[model samples]
Target chain A: MIILNQSKLNPSNIQPSEITSREVFENRRHFLKAAGFGLAAGSALLLSKQSQAAIAPVTFKANSRQKISGFSKTAYGAGEKLTQYEDVTTYNNYYEFGTGKSDPAIQATLFKPRPWTISIEGQVKKAKTISIEDLLKLAPLEERIYRMRCVEAWSMVIPWVGLPLASLVKWAEPTGNAKYIEFISESDPQSMPGVRSPILDWPYTEGLRMDEATNPLTLLAVGLYGEYLPNQNGAPVRLVTPWKYGFKGGKAIVKIRFVEKMPLTTWYKAGPSEYGFYANVNPNVDHPRWTQSSEKPIGAGLFGGRIKTKMFNGYSEQVAHMYTGMDLNRNF
Target chain B: MKKQHIVFVKAAIWLFALLPLARLIWLGVNDNLGANPIEFIEHSTGTWALVFLLITLGMTPIRLLTGQVWQIQLRRVLGLFMFFYACLHIITYVWLDFVFMWDELLIDVAKHPRILVGFAAFLLAIPLAATSNSYMIKRLKTNWKKLHQAVYLIAILAVVHFWMLVKKDLTEPIYYAVVLIVLLGIRVYFKYKPLSKSKVIKAM
Candidate 1:
């Protein structure tokens, strides 16, 4: 216990200058913006350190990404601390951009997530292409603060702004034969470097059972932190299943299909033995390579302690009933 | 090579070997270790350990292929450096990553094959690191050669441990595996091949 309690010691206090500061993640983007501002606003801003004041501490880069105007905050994970916007945006696993955690932020800079239309096919009644505009209009956007646990034993709290996936399913008008919903991400080799590599089969696919797809807890997130999705974070539109691992949500989705049989997901096909179709965040069921019993909180700084992962990522009340009588360990 | 040149080369290797540790400290000081500092440290130290171990294994191959005896003399220091980083990696995993939770650490070593394999590599390294001194090397005699050969197993375990840890995109680990295979392949080819008198004399 003596050594175990070492986590309680504040590393920052030992060496304030050397320790990882939360301000680093927060101020990194500001410094990038300041550098750009110094160039764009002319050499006057670069006169001295004080000249950085020309760029405010919080200058939202006027990129084309739109902001969601009227998203109402929800009680879901409201008490939890949101991961830093920089960390959430920069540290990602969208393999379409690349394999590295920071690859998407750098590599997806030129990726055009707009002009996107999700194609609905298979057993849907109204099988048609719906633009990003109509997708948002399906329902009022809600700012749902959800805990997303990655299978790699890391987790983040994100304030995702989007409509319930149930609304989109209702809009799709799936036929009675629809048993599972498969989400497909767009794969353009010219923009996405990872698509060129044979990492996972391109056009990354993920699926959810019929009940899970239409659950109120599930979301078709288009924006996060009040802004339209960053290109790296599956911009324009993507799926968000809080109860499952992050990879369960297909990023930058371009198609949704209503199918009878279970849809083969990218992860499921990649490692059939390790990744199961239903990748619910079950702490009891450990991943083949790593443990799921505990997860490191992203943006918790250097001396951060591990947090015990909750069942179904703490959305068990809303999601557990769906898995009733179904063995998640086997399904997982 | 001249005696003074060998000394200079060993000093240079020492400087170069210490850089990765210095870089970790620099990153810690600058807060550049990213969102998860534990992961960054673990990977940096673990990767450096593998890099040093591979280089140590390459020293004997250098002597075998080119008859450069000077290079093999640096193996002891290089092996010691590998042990240093491996120790750091294990400490980070047990203390910082698991917070010295004995049950979790035991479970990690006992349950997960990746952790178990990695732990085995570290345990095997201890005996070799202990015998990396002149006193033990002199006392152990012919047995020293036999005992230190455990590095071959340790190297394979290190690569296998890395191969299993990755979730997807096995590109990085595959490179290390390929290098290890080639290094071992050379020894096997030299050992079993029908030896020409002149070639054998040159290799010796």
Candidate 2:
């Protein structure tokens, strides 16, 4: 465990000359108004760097003693430390770069991230855009190792670095009428090969019900494995909802629209019967072709039998209240 | 034909048919088939079975159009190979994917429309393969022709199965559909077309 020196790190050095010159500042403000500052402290994390003023130096946790099935635990700094051996982090699903998991890591290297800004509008009372640089400065990064389960029945435990979605939601300040938040990725077919296919709408879209976004489990993941997320895994930034399937965690997110009703998701739109928008990871809810009772853990032997899936991906304490009396089988 | 030549040719054909089965066994042993090996194995065997089915179906039309009588005999071998691969495919899915989860399998077959179609195709292929042997053919000579009619139904169902499984990539399934359509079209035309007096062969 490495201790951080908060005295040495300052936001004055990291903050860009102007955060509102681009549209991202407006986006954050728009989201704040829509979500309606639920918790003041977390919301403060989303305001300008001047709020804290003093930067907290990052505390590094060496994963030398960590073991995940067949993989070795390595230090993954919140936004800087990453393991990039071609066979590892580079091969993944960062849908903004492409649909194939490995495509984003391989092709997203061509993307210039310095000018990135997100547009937040729709039903929000305060609509404003903000730059990506200012967004990172709002919160100090920390790591959490979470299990990611794909619809295809494979699982991976990733060390994600970012802030909770609640924090951003608080800053966005949801209005009384805002019922859901719709996330959209940039739609540039020339850069994203997966969008070229008619399988899903060109610009991928996902949504979280208003209550879900307020859940602490919802994360605004900026990086993984101690380094900036590889292009294949939603580089720059993405959302990670631990209780849901991987696809529900939209990658390479560009737009955040708070609306009065639930947003239409790409997968659900492509085949409604096959991919339900709720996309909760439930063992009882089987895929059309395959059963969801078990999952083949990634990094395990290819021939190994799958392990049984737990309810709500083992986050029943935090999320079970949301589903309270609903039948997961029917909702699934 | 010389006995040695016949033995060698028979061995070669048997070996050729077993090649895919051997490859599956090798991959299963080495654990190299990837995350969802059951799906991969099931798909590989099912694809090869379709290829063989298409080949067997083509022999009749090809022989009729080209006046090649020798090709008709190979049809039996090709049909049997198709059944052989199909058995491997189904067994893999049942034994590995479902793991003898009969109740769950039943529910799956009931819920998924595509599974029902695939199951129907698999059932139809069974009788056609069972009657391929000389003993079964001789015992049911009059009925053999009627039973073999199931192949046409199986071919159609197989194409439907392929089309439904693919999400967006249609290239491979489209290729199979095209071949099946041509083979099926020729059969239908031959059966229904009117023959002229000059073209009709006189029976001795």
- On DockQ, the leading prediction is 1
Would you list the clashing residue pairs of candidate 1? none
Per-residue alpha-carbon lDDT of model 2 for A49-88, expressed as tens digits? Answer: 4233232222212111111101112233223322212223
Q: What are the candidates' individual DockQ scores?
A: 0.50, 0.13
Among incorrect, acceptable, medium and high, the docking class of model 1 is medium
List model 2 lDDT by residue over B49-80, tens digit each: 89889988998887556655555766788888
Candidate 2 at A248: error in angstroms?
1.3
Q: Global lDDT of each model? A: 0.83, 0.69
Residue-by-residue lDDT tens digits, candidate 1, B1-204? 899998999999999999999999999998788878899899999999999999999987787777768788899999999999999999899878888777666766887998899999999999999988999999999999999999999999999999998877899999999999999998887787777843864756
